[model samples]
Target: MTRILVTGGAGYIGSIATHMLLEAGYEVSVLDDLSTGHKDAIDTRARFVEGSILDSDALTAALSNCSAVMHFAGKSLVGESVEKPDLYMQVNVEGSTKLLDAMKVAGIKDIVFSSSAATYGQPGDAPISEQSPTKPTNPYGVTKLKVDELLASRAVTDGIAAVSLRYFNVAGALQTSDGWLAERHNPETHLIPNIFKATPSAPLQVFGTDWPTPDNTCIRDYVHVLDLIDGHISALSIMKPGTYQVLNLGSGSGYSVREVIDTASRVAGRVMPSVDVARRAGDPAVLVASIEKAKKVLNWSPKRDLNQIMQDVVSSGA
Candidate 1:
């Protein structure tokens, strides 16, 4: 079996991808700091190395005998990034460069980088493609865009095969024979989980209703976590050397804040509460993905819809 190193493999998406990669017959080694990740979420079938990407000695030790790396390690809170831009650059940008330098010494040439759709900033159009302008507004998005550029440039000069999967809002969990992996970000910022946390009578704060969208609220695309994992495995199995690809993973459709809350209400069989609030700075009106390239390149398409996404999350009790 091909040995692969998965950074942040104890976190939400990384954990699921590690599980799937193990089941698919690869020898998986996970590198996580447990700073924001959970050890309980990691699969026992794979080897685990507890360390942050900043530790070069630990990274080199973990990279030994590995054929490829799936990088998902970084600080990633938009509001927090705004509060600490220096931290975002240091961790996301500087740490990634450290990983790349380590990979060079290790002679590992294959990688699948975790990027975010937030890199597109406040886009002028809906259904953004790979060619969309990458003017990230916040520190978090700026850092991810920097890593994408770093990986692309490395692929060109180093004969490395790397692909960056720019993800939209990721939701839901997967149930398997061993167990289920759920979204569990501390100080939870995800919409679905936060909605579940709200009481029926208490109002959930709906930020920004004065946008130019049809519902006058911000709109975004959400894809199931499992669907996003499928995209990773698809790219891992097919990418060739000396090539680079950037693809968007999302449901072709979008849901506004109002639409999401309404759907959550119907799905939970309760009236979800809401209080319209002021527009958040740098908040885009709509941010959906044009997954045509994803379908063509990864031979993948999202199978779950919003209702199923909410149902799965609720069922998982995440």
Candidate 2:
């Protein structure tokens, strides 16, 4: 079996990817500090190594004898990045470099990095493609884009095959209930889960209903967790030495905040309460990905829609 080392394999998307890898007959080893990752989310098939990506020794050990590394460990909050820019740089940028160094020592060249659509910042057009200009509006995005640059340079210089999948808003849950991984951040900022948790009783808060969108609410491209993992796995299989690629992973459809809440309410068989509020800083009016490159290269497309995304979230009971 191909040995794959996944950083943050106990976290939301990482854990789901790890599960998929194991199911596909890969020997998976996970390296995570469990800072934001839940222990229960890890698949039993994967070997879990408790550590941070900042620790080169631990990373080296984890990468030893592995065929490739899937990096998902990093600070991911946009608002928090604005408040603590240094932390985002230290973890997302510096730590990613450290992981690369470890891979260099281990002679492992292939890497699938988990990037974000935030790297594009506020795109001037909807359905932004991989060729879109990356003018990140926040520190979180800045760090991710910097890592992409680093990976590109390293791929040319060190002969590393790297593919960064710039994901939009990753919502929904894994299909199986046996290993359900839900969003559980301290002071959570994601709209879907927060709205799901506050439905029927508490009113979901909608920020800045004055944006230039259809409902004056921020619109985001939602990708199912399963679809996102499928893209990662496909990228991992096709990555060639000295090759570098960046592709957007999203459903190519944008949904407003109100639409999401309404969909969730319908899925849950209950009416969800919500109120409009002032827009928050660094919040883009709309973020919809153009997934044509992903389809052309990886032959991947989102099989699930927004309604399926909401149903998955509701089913997870997370």
Candidate 3:
């Protein structure tokens, strides 16, 4: 079996992807610091090492003999990144450098990095494509874009092949026995999860209703976690040497903040809350994906829709 090392394999998307990797007959090992990832999400079939990417010793041990590394560990909150830019750089940029160094030393030529759509930072149009200009407005996006540049440069100089899968809003749970890898950050900011948890009596807070879109709220492309994982695997399996590619992963449709809340209310069988708040700084009107490259390259199409996303997420009881 091909040996794959998944960083942050116990976290939300990482854990689900690890399970899929194991199911596909690969020998999977997870390296996580448990900072935001849960230990229980790990599958018993795969080996687990409790470590962070910052620790070179731990990374070296986990990466040894691994055929490829699927990097998913990082600080991902945009709001938090604005507040703590240093933390984002430490984990996303510096930690990624350490992993790349270790991969070089170990001669691991394949890498599938977990990038974000935040890298686009309010592009000129909807359905953002790979060619879209990446002028990230926030530190979180800036760091991811920087890492993508580093990986591409490394791929050119070295023989390492890397593909950065830029994901939009990843929602829903893994189709597993373990409860859905729910969002449980210190300050939970995602729309779907927060809407699900809100009581009918309490109004759900909607940010920025003065944007140029149909609804003043921000618009985003939502991809089920399963589809996101599948995209990662597809990228890793098909990537050729001397190539560094960046692909956007999301359902080709966009949903506004109000649309998401309404859908969640229906799925949860409860009246959800609504509270229109001030527009957040740097909030873009619409952030959707153009998955033409993904469909052509990976031969992948998202099987789940927004309703499915809401249903699966509510069923997970996260």
Candidate 4:
């Protein structure tokens, strides 16, 4: 069986990928510092290297006997990224370069990166294609775009085979023998989970009430975590040496903030209370992905919808 290195394998999406890869008969080695990921979330079937991607020795150890990498490790919170731009650069951009260097030394040429739709900041109403202009409004998006650029460059100069899956908002959970692998961020910022967490005293704060969207709230494309991972697996099969591709992973449709709140309320059989607030800095009014390229190239499309996402999250108790 081929061994694959999964960086940040203890986190929500990475953990699910690790589990699914194992189920698909791949030997996996997981590298994570447990900074944002959880040690318990790392699948016991895989070799676990508890260290950050920034550590060269850790990268070398994790890459051992691995034929390819599924790079999911990085600082991802947009608001936090705004506060600590330097941290985002050091970890996301610089750490990715280090991973590439380790890959070169280890003779592993294939990688599937966890990029974001944030790269196309404020690309309005229409679904964004891979060919869309990249104008990232936040440092988190900037770092992801930088890593994509690096991968493209490496593909040209170093014969690397890479596919960057530029994801929109990833939500929902995956079931496992141990339990549900779900979102467990310390300061939960995602919509679905936070919707469940909202109570009478601490209702979820709706970020912006006055965007130009139909609902007058920020609109975003959300893909279930399972569908997102499927895209990653499909990407692994289509990687061509000395070539790079960027594919957007999202539902073709979008949901406004209020729509999500209402959906959650309906799904949970209660009123999900929320209050309107001022717009966040660096927030795009709308971000929806055009998955046409992914559908044509990888032969993949999301099988789940926003309602299913909300239902799964509610059922998982995440």
Alpha-carbon local distance difference test for all models: 0.89, 0.88, 0.88, 0.92
lDDT of 1 by residue, 1-318 (tens): 799899999999999999989888999999999988999999999899999798999899889889999999989899999999999999899988888889999999999999999899977867899899999988999999999999889888988889999999999887877777898898888888888888757678899888888888888899998889889989987678888889999998999989998988898888777888887666778899999999998899999999999898877864
**Candidate 4 local lDDT, 142-209, one digit each (tens):** 99999999999999999999999999899988889898889999888888889899888988898888
User: Model 3, range 180-249, lDDT digits (tens) per residue?
Assistant: 6655565677888888767657667888888888876788899998888888888877877888999889
Winner by lDDT:
4
What lDDT does model 4 reach?
0.92
Cα miss at 60, model 2 (Å)? Answer: 1.6
Q: What's the TM-score of each model vs. the native? A: 0.96, 0.96, 0.96, 0.97
Q: Flag regions of model 4 displaced more than 4 Å.
A: none
- lDDT measured at residue 20 in model 1 versus the true structure, 0 to 100: 89
Show the lowest summed lDDT stretch of 10 residues, model 3.
177-186
Instruction: List, residue by residue over 1-318, the lDDT tens digit for candidate 2.
Output: 799999999888999899889888889999999988988888887888889999988897788779899999999988899999999999999999999998998889999999999899888877899888999998999999999999999999999999999999898888654846766677777888888667445678888988888888888889998999989989987898997899999999999988898888888888778877788776778889999999999999999998988887887776
Whole-model alpha-carbon lDDT for candidate 1: 0.89
